[model samples]
Target: MPTSENTFHLGLTMAGAVSAGCYTSGVIDYLFEVLDLWEKAKRGNVQGIDQNLVPKHNVIIDAMGGTSAGGMTTIISTLYALKGKLKPVKKIPENPMENQNVLYDSWVHLDDNEEKTFKKIWDVDDLDGELTSLFNSKVIDAIATKALDMGGDVNDFESYVSENLPRFISKDLEILLSHTLLRGIPLSVDFKTEIARRLKNSPMHNTFEHYLVSHFKLNSGNPVNENSYLWFNPFKEKYSDKIKLSTISTGAFPIGLAYRKFDNTQFSDEYIKSVTRRVIFGDFGSENPDVNHDIELNNYPENYSSISVDGGAINNEPYREVGSILRSKFHKDENEYQNYGLIMIDPFPDNDDIERKYKEPKNLLKVVPAIIQTLWNQAKVKRKEMLEQYNHDFFKGVIYPIKHRIINGEYKGRDKNPIISASFNAFGGFLDVNFRVHDFFLGRNNARNFVQYFGCIPYDPDNGNVHPIHREWTNEMVEKFKVSRRGDERIFLPIIPDLNLLLEGKEPGDDKYNYTYKGKPKYNPSELFKLKDNIYNRFKKVLDKGFDSFGEKTEEESETPISDALIRREYRRNWFQRMGDNVKSWVVGKFKNPVKKAIASMLSKFVIKSILEDLEQMEVLDDKAN
Candidate 1:
C-alpha cells in the first residue's frame, strides 16, 4: 500500500523514432520546467556535476518507459535531470541589423566572453549547433571516412547504376549488394563509440534499478519514505555494461545490420553468422530478465551468443511495461478513484497508410521485395492496433495519450508526424540550425497545450480541482467551458439556461410549483437537451457524407469512434488470466519474430539477384537488335 505522503503515481512512456528523438527531449525539458524541478534537483548535486554524474534528488516520475530511439531519449533525459541540465535549445541568429537580440540571442554563444543562459522560452540558442557539430565530428564524419578507407563509398552504387543505363534496365545489381554490405561496419562502430564516450565517467554504471533510487532520500538527510522508482527499458539483457550499451542495444537494427562487437575476434566470418542466427531465432532469456542478477560476459559465454537488436522490432511501444507497473503498485489500494495514471507520448499515432497500387508483376520473382515491404509495414500497423485495443480495454479512463504536434516552421515540410518521420528531403531547413530549434520549441509548446486540457482525475472526482475543460456542471465554470466527446477536438459550447427553473426561482414565496415535493431535474434539463442535440447533429453530418455513424473510419476531416464493446472485447486477457496467457504468448513469440526475419532475409537475398537476371536478359535482346 502507498503511504499518504506518496499517494500519487505518475508514469511517462515515450515511443521510438530515429532522429525525431530531439522532439521528445524538448517535451521532457518543458515537463521539468512545469514541475519546477530543475532548481531543486540542482541544489543537491553541485559536486556530482563537477564529476560529470547525474544529480541525486527531485525526480517526479514514478515509472518511466521507452523503446528504440525513445530508449536513447529516456537515458539522456534521466542523465540531464540528474545533472540539472537542459537539452540544448537554440536557433541561429537572424536579421542582425534590425534586431541585435536576434543576432546573439542564445543560451550558448560562440565566444568565451559569452555565458549560457537558462530561459523559459527556447527561442534563442547556440548550444544546439555546437552539439550537432560534435556529433558530426565524432560519429557521422568518422563513419564516412571509414567507409571511404574501405576502398569504396555507398554512393558509388548509385553512380555505377546511373552511368550504365542499359545494365540497370537489364537488372544488373552486383555493384549494389557490394556497396550495401560495407555500410554495416562503420555505422555500428561509431554509434557505439559515441555512446560510450558520453557516459564514460558516470557513477552508477550497472542496472537501471541501481541508478534510479529514491533521490529525495539520497543521503538520509530527509525523513521521507522511499519512493518506488519503477523503470522499464525494452532493450533486454542489461548487465554491468548497460551504461555503455543500453541505448545502442535498443536502437540496433536486426540480423547484424547495426551490430559491433567490442571484442578482438569481432571481424571473423563464423562469429558474425552465429550472432545473426542467434538474434533472429533464439530468445533473450525471459520476458523479464532478472533485474538484480549481473551476468558477467566471460562467465556466461552461452548468454553472449545472442545480441540485442532494436526494441521496436519486438515492442515499439512500452505500454505493457507501464501497464504492469500501475497494476503491481496500486492493485492493493482498491479505491474506485485511484491516484495513479499513465501519460503516453506516441510519436507514431495510427494513420491511414497511403499504400501504393502496383501493376501486375511481369515476373513473379520481381514482386518479392514489394510483398516483403508491405508485410513488414502491415505488421507494424497491426501491432499498434492490438496495443491500442488492449490499453483501451484495461486502462481507458486512466491513460492519457499525447501525440506530438506537427513541427511547424519554414522547414516543417510534408512530414506531419515529425516525432517519428525524418523528412530528409526538406530544403535547407533540416540541415539548418533553425530546423532543430523549431523541433525543440514544437515539443515544448505541445506539452504546454496538453497540460491545459488533460490531467489525472483527482481522488475526489466531484468537488475536486479539475481543469476548466472538465467542469461543465459547476455554477461558476458552466458558462465559461465546454465538453466534447473523447474523439472530437475540444470546442466551446454556448450556455443554455433552464427557463423553467429560472422562472421558479423568481417566484420565491409562491407555493404554485410545490418546491418540496418535486426534484429540480438533478442539475439542468436544458443542458442535457443541448448535449443530446449536439451529438445528433454530429451524427447526421457524418451520415450525409455517406459515412456510417457506427463504423470506424479515418478521413481528411475527422476520426469517428467505433463500438466501445468491440474494442474492449478484442484484447480482454488480463491479470486474472496472466498464468495461462504467459504460456500462450511464449508459443506465439517463438514463431512471430522468425516469420518477420524470414521475410526480411528473403527480400535481401532475392531482390538483387532478380535485378541482375533481368539485366542479362536485356543485354541479350540488345545483341539480337544489333
Candidate 2:
C-alpha cells in the first residue's frame, strides 16, 4: 500500500471530432459539471464518493493531451483550472461559445461597463454595410499596406489576402480577439509575439510549463511515424519563439481552410532547402492514426522544420501520450502506478446506425459521419488494447471503462442507436439537452458503474458472492450531497440549478437554487480591475485611430429622394382608398360574423379589382415615360 506522502497522477485526454460541433459543446458542458462536482467533493459537499474512492486531497491533473478541436478545449480548460477560475456555476447554456460569461468567464470576464463597451464594438444594426466597412478599413487596408511595402499590386494582394484569410475569420476573429483582450493581451502587428509574451508573463505559466502541442510534417510521404511527429513545448526557452505560432499552425485544418506558413525569414536557408522551401502547415489530425500504440517505442525527431499537420490523423485520443509519459516517469514500482488516475473526455461522434440512415456517401454531409466512424473505430481498438494491457499487468487495474449512452430525445421515428441518437441529439438541440443528458447519465449511471467496477472490496471465491460498491443514490441524496455547510448558514446553491430543480424538491424555474459567489473573492482586485481598464483603454485607442490609417471613411450627408407630383398624387389616392376599404371590410366582418364571407367576397371583387386596375394604369404610364 502506498503511503500518504505518495500522490496519484491524473491524466486527462480530450478527443477530436471536428464535425460534431454540438457533441463538442456537450463535452465542454460535461467538463464544467465535473469540475463543479470535484470542487464540491473536495469541500465535502458531495456524498457519492466512498472512503476508497475519495482522494486524500483534490486530485491534481498530472498530464493532459488532446487533438484538433479537443486540443483547443483542453488548452482552454487547463488554463481555466490553472488560473483557479473553474468555479461552480449554473448549467451550461445552449451555445456555450455564445455564453462566454458563463463558460469562459475567466477568459472573458466583464464588469457592467465593459459589457457595454463590447456590445458597442460587436452590435451592428446594419450588419452588411458595417461589416463591409470594417473589412475594407481593417483587413483590406492592412493587406494593401503590406502589399505596397512589398511592391505587390493591390489587386493581386487583395486576392491573396482573401485566399489566405477567408470568411471564417469574420466569424471567429471577434471572439478570439475578445478572449485575448480579456486576458490583458493587446493586439499588435505580430500576434504570435504578443501571445508568447503573455504566456511567459502569465501567473499560471508554471502550471502549463510542461504542456505539449503535437504536430506532423505535412509534406511527409509516409503516414505519421515517430520521425513525422513534432512536439511543441511552449514554455521551453528554445522553442518559445515558434511555440504560439506552431500551436495555431497545428490546429489549422486542411479542408476548406488555408494552410499556414511561417513568414520566410523565420526559417534558416539550410532548413528551407531540406524541405524544398514548401512551407505549409495543416491540422495535426491529418497524421493521427487513431489507434492504441506503444508510446515508449516512439521517438521525437531532432529537427524543427516548417511543415506540420493535425494530430487526429494518427491519434484522435492522445491517452497513449499521457500514459507513456507516466510510465517513463514511474515504471519501476507498481504501487506508484496505482496512485495515479486517468480521465479521458472523448466527444467524438461514434454511431454507425444513425450514419447508415444517410445513404449517399459522396455527399458533403457524409464526410462528418465518415470521420466519426473512423474515430469511433479507432477508440474501440484503443479500448480493447487498454483492457488487454490491464489483464497483462501493464495498467495494474487503473483503467475504468464507462459505456457510452446515447441521449436522443424520446421522439417518434428517432434513430435507436446510441451513437446516432447522441449525434442527432447534440445537433438538434444545439447541445442544450445533450449537456443535460450527459450530466444526468454521469450522476445516475456512470458514477455508480465506476464505483462498482473499481470498488476496493475483494471478491469471495467461496460462494461467488462479491460485495457490491454502495454507490447508489436517489435525487434527494444527490441534492443533499450538493448542499455545503461552511458557516452558520448552509449554502444550498447547486452547481447546476436545472438539475436541482428537476431532481430535488426545488420548484421548476426557481432561480434561488443557482450557484452564487459568497465566499472570499476568487479574483484579485488589482488584477481584475486593472486588466479591464487596460483592455478598454487599448480598445478605445484602436477605435479612435482606426484599425488602419488607410481606407478610413468620412460620414456622408443624407440626400432627399426626388418625388414626382403625378406619382405621389396617384400613390396617395391608391393608399387612402385601400386603407378605407380594408377598414370598412374589417368593421363589417366584425359586426356580422355570419355574413363575413359575403362581405369579403364583395370587397375582393369591388375594392381589390379597382386597386389592381389603377396600379396597372400607373405602371403603363411609368413605363411609357421611362
Candidate 3:
C-alpha cells in the first residue's frame, strides 16, 4: 500500500513552452516566499501575517503535474524538496552573467568545462568520437547479443550481408548504418543502470514509489498488443525499480530521440518460443497524454488504445490531471481539498488578440484564410471541452468573469461614471466596480464636502484624460490614491523580477546577446539564463540559508563549499553537453527528410533484384544437394 500524508492540497501544474523554465522559476520563488513568510511568522518577525497562511512542509504539495520542459522542472523541484534541499527566495543581481554564474554554481555541481570528464571516460576528444563510441559499444553490442541468441555468429551476419546485399556495401553506407544504429537504439542499458544507481540514493525515491504517475506508450503496430498505455504504479517494487528509465522514455521527445522499447514478458511464453523477442514501445506524448481528449477525464482504461503524440496536441497546460485528482479527493470528503490551492505556471505567450484572430481568420490569400479558419474553429472546440471539465461554479466565479470582463469593454476606455474620480488611473478605470460604488455610497458625505468645497471638475472629453482640479485638499486625494496604489502593488508582488525586466524590453544580462534575429528581438540566451538563475537562487536561498555567501561555508555546514573556478567548469560542461544534444537532433532531423526519399526510391529497385538473386542462389544449393 502507498503511504499517504494528511496535508493541504496544493496542486501545481506547468504549461509547455520554451519559457517554461522562467515560469517554473517564478513558481519556486513564490514557494520560497511562502516558506520564508511562514518561518518569519513562527519567529514573530513577520507582522500582520498568520503562520497558518503558509502550509506546513510535509503537507505543502498534494500533487504536481507538468508537460515537456515544465515536466522536467516539476521532477527536479519535487526531488530537491524531498531531499530537503529547497533554497530560499532572494533578489537576483542585475548583471546577467553574474546571475548566470550563480545558477551554474548551485545546480549540477561542476565547472563549465567539467563535461570534458566525459571525454576522459569515453577516451574521445570530440562529440563525433563520443557518438561513434556510443554506437559501437551500445548499439553493436545489442545487435550482436540478439544475433547470438538467434544461433548466428558475427561472421554469419557478415556473410549474409555480402551475399544478399551487394549494393548496400560502401564506406558512406557503413557510416549511415552507424548513424541509423545510433537512432534506433538511443538509450543504452549502461545509461539506464546509471540512472537507477542515482535514484537509489535520491530523497524522492519513496515519494516516487508512491505518488509519481508516469505516462508511457506500447507499440500499437506490434502483433502482441495493438495499442496499450503503460500507467506505471511506482508504489510497486517492480515498477519503482524502473522509474528512472520510465521517466526518460516517456519524456523523450520524438523529434531526435528514438522510441524506447521494453521486452513484452506477457507474450514471452506463446510468442518467443525459446527467447522473448517481442518488444513494445512508442512516444508517451502521443494523442495528448496529459489531457487524453478522446476519453473521459476519470476513465483511464486498463489498456489505453489511442495513438500517442505530443502532449501539446490537445493542450499545453497539464492542469487537468491535477484538477481531476483534487476533484476526486473533494468528492471523497477529503478535508485537504477544503484548503486546496491550484497554481498554474504558464510560460506560453499570452496574446490578447488570440480570440479576435480565432473569430476573424483574415488573410491575403483565400485558401490560407480557409485553412486558418478551420484550425481556429478546432481550437475553440478544444478550449470549450477543457473549460467544461472544470467546476462550473468555480469557473464562473474565477475564470469566466475575467473572460467576460475582458471581452465586454471592461478592460478598455476610462471610467465615465461620476464617482470616485481619480487622476492616476493608468488602466483607465478601476477593475472592481463594486468597490468604486462602495467608496461613493459609504463616503457620500465626504464626496459632497469635497465637491462643495473645491467644485466639481469634469474630465476633458476631447483629450480623453482625467484632469482633476488642483486644490489644497486635493493633497488628501493624492494620499488616498497612493494608499490605493499600494494595494494594487500586491498583485504584482509574486512576479519574478527577471521576467519584469524582459517585459520592459531590456536585455536581462546574456553573455552572447544577439541584437535581433529576422527583425525580432532575439533574447533567447538571456531569457534562458535568467530562468536558470531564478531556479538556482530559489534553491540556494532556501536550503543553504546558514551559508554567509554562495562560495563560503560555515564551520557547522557539512557540505563542502564550491569554488568559483569549479562553478565555471561545470557550466561549460553542461553547455557542451547541451550543444552535443542539439547537434545530434539537428543532424537526425536533416537526415530524416532525405533518407525517406532515398529509401523509397532505392527499396523499389533493391527488393526485386535481391529476391531474384537469392532465388538463383537457392537453385544452385538445391543442385549441390541433388
Candidate 4:
C-alpha cells in the first residue's frame, strides 16, 4: 500500500509482477529475469552494473518494468526517473493497459490480434464473472429479452447497460500474441456460459430442499461464539473423489483461484481431514514434501478430469512416431496423460518418476514454508516496481485521492474505472491484500487460513456436514501441530492460530481446552469479532441441501441445517459493526490525506485520463462560447 515516489525508487516494479494479468512464457520469463535483477538490484547491480535502484541508464528496463507508456508525457514523467538528460525511449505504444477506457474495452472484445496488448490480453473469463452480479437483477433479463426481440432502438437500449457491465466484459488481461482468442463478441461461447452461471444461483437449483426443511437433521446455528465470516466451508464430494465444478460457487468480488462450492455440507471428519491434506500437500504435490521442484510432479499424475477416456488409464506407450514426424522425438521417460475414474473427466498429462537428483522430498512442514518462500520470491521479483512505487516518496501524491475516494465511497458506482472493474471481473479480481501479505511478506503460517478460507467449497457430498476451514484429516503432521510439538520444521504449535482463533484470539480456557478461563486472565473477542457473522454458514446450508445434495448423498449422513434466523442475526450484528469500523477508518484516513496530495498521487492516472477529456471539454466550452 505504500505510495510511489520519484526521488528514491524503493520498489514499484513489484506491482507489475503481482497482477500483470496475463500468463505467458514471455511475461513469465520477464518476471523471472526481473527477479534475477531484483536479487542484483538489492545490491544495485544489473550485469555487474551497480547504481542507485533507479539509475538514468536503467530507464528502458525500469520503464518496461511497469505497465506505463513512455511517450513525451510519461517521458516527461520519467524526467523523475532521469537525473536530467538521456535521450529517453521517446516513442512508446500510446495504448497502455492501465490507461484509456476504450482501449481497455477493446481488449475485452476478444479475438483481437497482438494478444499482449492490454486490450488484447484482457481475460474474458473475468468479465463473465462481472455479469454474474446481475443474476439477481431483473433489468439484465429485460435487456436480454429485448435484445432477443431485435425490434427496438438498440442504441437507446444499450444506454440501459450498466457501466460496470461493460467494464467487466472488456477487461483485457494484456497478453501478447497467441491463438487464444482476443477481444471480440464471444456470443457463441458466452451465450451458454452466462446462462449456466445464472442457473447456478437459483434457489430451486437443488433437488433436496424439501428434505432439508422437513428432516432438519443437519441443522446448525451460526457458530457465532466463534468470530468468522462464513459459518462453514462446504465441499462437493468426498476427498479423493470427483471434483464437481458445477456445484462450485464464487466468493467475494474480484477473486483469484478457480470457482469454489462454498456450501459447507461436507463437515464429516473424513472431509475435514482430506481438505487439510490437500491444502498442505496437494498444492505442492503430495510427494514426501521434501524434494522441492517441478519434479515433485513426476509421481503426480497429470490431471485426469476423466477416466475411460484414454483406455481407462495412462498409456505409457511413447509417441515417438508423432514426435519424430514433428521433428521432436519423445524420450523414453517423457510425460504422458492419465485418466482417473468419473471423479475426473479430462485426460491429464502423465508424469511418473524417472528419478532425478532433486526430484524428491525429505520433509513435510517444509512444504508450506517452501511454497511460501517461493511465491514470496516470485512476487517480489516480478512486481517490485508496483509494490515499491513510492520508495522515492512519489506516492504521497498518487495514493491520496484513491484514499479519499475510498473514504468517500465515490467508487461504489462501477463506471468510475471501467478498466479496473472489467479486469477484476475477468481475472477474478485481485488477490486479497491479506493474501498478498501471505505471498510475499516474511511469515510462517503462510496465509494458511486465508488459503483455506478461499479454497474450501461448502456443499461437498462425501461428508454431509459443512466444515469451513474444516480440519478433515489428522495426520502425523497435523498431530504434530496439535501437540505443539517440534515438527519437522524445527518447531510445532508455532503459535499458528486457525481462522477461528485469529478471529477470536485464544482465551485462557480455550487454549487449554478448559472452555472457561481457570485462574488465568480471560481473553474476549475483540471489536473485529463483533463484526463477524455466520452468514456464510446459513447460505452454505441452503446450498448443500440443494446444489450438491451433499448432506443426503450418503446413507450414513442426514441433511440438517443450522437455524437461519439465528445465523442471520449474528452476521447482521457483525457486518454492522464492521461497517462502523470501516467508516471510522475512512473518516480518519480521508481528512488526513490532503486533496493536493491525493491529486498529486493519483495525478498519473487522473492526468493521463483527464488530458484528452480536458481537451474535449475545452472544445465543447469554446463551441458554447461561440
Q: Give Cα-based local distance difference scores for all models.
A: 0.34, 0.34, 0.30, 0.21
Candidate 1: segments with Cα more than 4 A from true spot: 1-6, 37-59, 85-241, 253-257, 261-303, 332-335, 354-366, 374-421, 425-430, 456-626
Residues 1-626 of candidate 4: C-alpha lDDT, one tens digit per residue: 11111111111111111121211111122222332343344354444432321112111121111111101011111111111111211122233222211212112221223332222221233332222221122221221222122122322212222221111111111100000001111111123354565674433211110000000000021121111111211111131011111111101111122222222342232322222222222221121223353211112112211101110111111111111111111112222111000000011112345785553445887677778756544522323334433332211110000100122423333112211111222231121111111111111111222112211222232444322222232343233223212343222221112322323333212332111111111112131122122212222232332333322355564344456666776767677888999998798667643543343345334422443243233221122321
Could you arrange the candidates by TM-score from highest to lowest? 1, 2, 3, 4
The best candidate in terms of lDDT: 1
lDDT accuracy of residue 409 in candidate 3 = 25
Pairing residues by index, what is the TM-score of model 3? 0.35
TM-score: model 4 vs. ground truth: 0.18
**Candidate 3, poorest ten consecutive residues by summed lDDT:** 171-180
| Model 2 score (lDDT) | 0.34
Q: Of the candidates numbered 1 and 4, which has the greater lDDT value?
A: 1
Work out how many backbone clashes candidate 3 has: 23
Tens digit per residue, CA lDDT, model 2, 1-626: 22323333345566654323223333444444554554455456666453333333322344555665455545444333322234433443344234342323311121112232222322233233322221112211221122112222233323333343211111111000000000111111223455675674433221101112333221111222333343222223333244344434334333211233453344333332222211111112223333353112112223323333344544566665555444443344543324344455554434457655655578769888898877646533555446645632332222111333223432233222222112221221111222223332222232222222231222232444221111222344334333433462322322122223222434422322122211111112232232343333333333433433434676775353355555676677667888999999789657654454344345334432443243233221122321
Pitting candidate 1 against candidate 3, the one with the higher lDDT is 1
Candidate with more favorable, higher lDDT: 1 or 2: 1
Name the weakest run of 10 consecutive residues (lDDT summed) in model 4.
Answer: 209-218
RMSD of each: 27.8, 23.3, 29.4, 29.4
| lDDT (Cα, tens digit) per residue for candidate 3, span 127-219 | 232122110122212212221121222233233333332120111110000000111111112233546766744322110000122432111
